[model samples]
Target chain A: MTINFDNAATTFPKPVSVANAIFKAVKQYGGNAGRGGHKLTLLTSEKVFDTRQTAADFFGAQTENVIFTVNCTHALNFAIQGIMSNGGHIIISGIEHNSSARPVYALAKKKKCTFSIAEVSDDPDETVNNFRSLINHNTKAIVCTIAGNVTGQIMPYKEIGKLCQEKNICFIADGAQACGTLDIKMSDGINILCTAGHKGLYGPTGTGLLISDGKYHITPLIQGGTGSSSLNLEHPDILPDGMESGTLNVIGIIALKNGIEFVRDMGTAKIFKHEDKLCRQFINGLSDTRTIIYRSPGVEYVPIVSFNIPDMKPEDVAEKLDQQGFCLRAGLHCSPLAHYSMGTTDGTVRFAPSVFNNENQVESLVKTIKKIQKI
Target chain B: MNMTAVSMPSVTLAIKAKRMLNEQGFKCTVKRAANVSENGCTHMIVVNGAPEIVIAFLDKYNIAYGKLLGDAMPQ
Candidate 1:
């Protein structure tokens, strides 16, 4: 059996309950949710709302504020573009996934707005100051990642959130990597939080969430039949219905409900500990090898660990590992900005563990890495 | 029983209102409101209780709603 360590991209081997929920939802929920009030539609609608409530309660948000999307990219697009639609300056961290980077870049490219990049520093305080120094009169919002995807570097988002609050700037956080591992909430001074249900939450790939604290008015990215305000040409000015314009992925959403329940039952702390233990084990086992680990002593990170083998390409290394029955992601990991910031033009292999991984598997991977270094 | 239909902007809001009202021992059912042509499409919470009490509960929870469609409304 292949041991999967590429959980950062999309968790593999989802909980059995999540799979069961998918099977059940496919058979039972066959109606368009929120389209009507028939028994079939209502049943689907109730299930959709139940998942929304679960997500809201998990994230410390009101039920109405949870807007579902296809993935983290879609959520970030909605939040970034929605807030910047009126045109203003925005700041994004230097190490950002393309999901956040590309949209902000598109806005700047279209001359709709201008943006600045805050260089993330080793010290959390200096990183916050880097963002603080970029603020100006036209700075309408600050888009940052809760934890970067490439190297799993945890940014001091709360400090930046406080900075946004003090400056009256809207703080939008990309929580794709941190959601299931960290206890995040709107109370962290974040105006908006976007994340993938598939990553840390162990949900299906097509589910994402955009949560708001009900403060800023984000223009809708897409508008269509929301089953409300249908007679009017204009989109309804509401929390979720305003943002969610198309029919939702009901099957994926119901499965996501079960996924979130699994997370809640296991507890974020316990899950983090399990994954982190695997990371530590991997790091320790690779200590005697020639592999270069990307972690810094003073920086905080999630369970992901990026490393490079001396004089070898990341993809080649990943290929070798794959032959040994291991799964690891290689390349820029869809975060070119992060690669540039780290000066890794070719990228590095990422080892991301899930709660299902254990020390024995990590040891085998570590031994494989050592064997690869000798090749 | 004095019944009223409370118009909510969306089915989510309507369902939310119904859940809140039902939990408090008030009878509620969600149904698509009769098309108010000029006002557009929306949903309503049919409550088998005082309309004033229903409105008060909605207001307390910050739930948004439109004008009441009136008493003895079609469910």
Candidate 2:
């Protein structure tokens, strides 16, 4: 049987309930959310709205503050471009994914804002201190990820959030890699949290969330009908309706609720333990391999492992592994900044296993790599 | 089921209020206003149960709504 290891992109073999929910929604609850007075529309809207409350409860934010988007990147774009409209400065870490880095660079190219990347230190205090030292009067927002997507390095973002609270700067965290594995509380001083539903939340590909604390106003990325203010050409100022324009992905959102239910029922701790154990096993198995190189502290909550074989390109290993009936990702993983920081300029093979993946699969993966090394 | 109209300042607010009540076990639906008045919004929320229950609950939440009318909209 083939083993799938690229779960960081999107979890495979979704919980039965989530799959059933997507089908049920499309077949039964096929109606536009918040668009009509018909029974179907109202029922659909009610369920979707309940998902908002569920997501808010999950993210430690109020119901109204949670807004749905196409994906994590869309959420991040809304948070970044929404808050930084006036154009100022921001602080990011060396481990930022292009979701954050690319947007910041694009803004800078347009002369909208300027930013600085604080050095990532192994020591949490030093990393926090690096962020502290970089803060200036012009700093408008501090957009950082809860963990490095490529390295699984958990940055001490709460400390940075606390610093933002003290200085009144917006804290936007990309929770794509950490949301399901880690508990990101709003009390941690995160003004805005963006994440993908497929990565950790087990939702469909077209679903994501942007949970914000009702402190600052973020300009909507697009403007159109919100179903509420149909009579007026202007968009409603209320949240969800303000940020959410056009017909939302009702079927996807419905399935997302079921996905969150699966996570909630399975308990994130148990899922993390299972995936972490597999990651730890993989790391321990590779300890004796002198030619293998990988990122450290393998016992991380998120099960992402980045590594490469000496004198062999990552793509070659990935291709060979593919032939061996193992699916693994290779190359930059979309975060050139992360590769630069990890000193893997050429990139590395990334294996992100989901809760559905088991120890047997991990052993088979390690065995394949060892066999490949000898050839 | 016959329902009473709970009008709010805005249509979105009306929908939000409907969900709030529905979440509390009250069945509610969004309905276009019986008669389009210059001052009020075009939409209103129809909630089931006694008018007193709607008023007390709406007041408890500090959600403003006009007096309850029967299910039939005014011509």
Candidate 3:
């Protein structure tokens, strides 16, 4: 019984319906979406549109605002580069993933743009205040991650969005780690949201999305044939066509449609409660362990826990755990900036539980960790 | 290859100069002056083109001013 605990990176054993949907699409209507007038093409296009609508409704966004991308990195690049080119100040969290941080760093170096970084706080209110302190006259945008990919510390987005609203700064959220796990709404004041379909959405890789309120226009990153206005050399200046250029991964999108539906039927609130309960149980069982160094207490974080056993390297621990048939992620998890913020330069073993993970698996994980600590 | 000089005060100005040089079909590499304060990012552009053409391009774009680092003429 291998216990998989790396849900934050990419979900495993995706919902059966998600797999079935992909299989059916490949076996049946495997055609280019929105390209041809054929029945198969139209059917595939409808499925893609349905996926977009489901995502919009789930995230409280308008249908036209949703644009598909290859992954969260692409979506984030589109938003950051597009907004920064206009020349304005920007604010980002110190705990941002490299996908968001690298672009801002590169642009800030090139553009005469003033930028500020809001510090993360263990307390949600203080975090919001940290963000408020950084805003100034020329501030153009605020970029935040819905949750820290490393710490799983959920940001107070509603308050931050409201602040952005009052200050008239574009509010952008990197939802790669939080989209399907948390209940997000556009009416809560989110201006732009980016998500990876492979994570909590339980879809295959090669699928992502960027949804905006259409207030700020983003210039296309890659310009090529969008299948619309093929004769024109210039790119079409439209909502989706402006951003989505070239061929799309139709099979991945088809699978994501069913994945979103599976999440919708299960209800995010219920999923949250279940994962939280499992996390609490795991934490409670390991409360007595003196070797484990757990950070960020008294905050409502996701079901992701990062801890290191005293005198043991995270990678070695992960190797041992793998031998014990427990799959987990060790090291910086590609967010070295986040690890720096948490002062874990050596990295820590992270256990992120998903809805499919059960209490028995949690028990086995806790027990295995306890045994490993003693060795 | 001809070399041109432009004075860029802020990091933003330096970056803009670098981007413009790259976009205009010039092989450019951005370097930082040793004397400049390292408190923030900096960029120095070295390009291959007519000195007057490069200087004019920078001037037209309103990039910050700097002295030509060396004397060189396009072959």
Top DockQ prediction, candidate number: 1
Best by TM-score: 1
Q: Model 2: residues >4 Å from true position, as ranges?
A: A291-293, A297-301, B1-4, B7-16, B22-27, B32-43, B48-75
lDDT of 3 by residue, A159-258 (tens): 9999999988899999898877788777778888988998888888999989998888887878976544444567766656567777678889889988
Judged by DockQ cut-offs, the docking class of candidate 1 is medium
DockQ measured for candidate 1: 0.66
In model 3, which regions exceed 4 Å deviation?
Answer: B1-75
- Give lDDT tens digits, candidate 2, residues B1-75: 445676654444566688789999998877756344333334577777677788888888766565565544433
In order, what lDDT does every prediction score? 0.91, 0.82, 0.78
Which of candidates 1 and 2 is the stronger one according to lDDT?
Answer: 1
For each model in turn, which proportion of the native inter-chain contacts is also found?
A: 0.62, 0.06, 0.00
State the weakest 10-residue window (summed lDDT) of model 3 chain A: A225-234
Per-candidate DockQ vs. reference: 0.66, 0.25, 0.01
TM-score of each model, paired residue for residue: 0.98, 0.91, 0.81
Tens-place lDDT per residue, model 1, A186-214, is: 89999999999999999999999999998
Best by lDDT: 1
- How far does residue A235 in candidate 3 sit from its true spot (Å)? 1.0
Q: Which pairs clash in the backbone of model 1?
A: none
- Specify the poorest-scoring 10-residue window by lDDT in model 2 chain B: B34-43
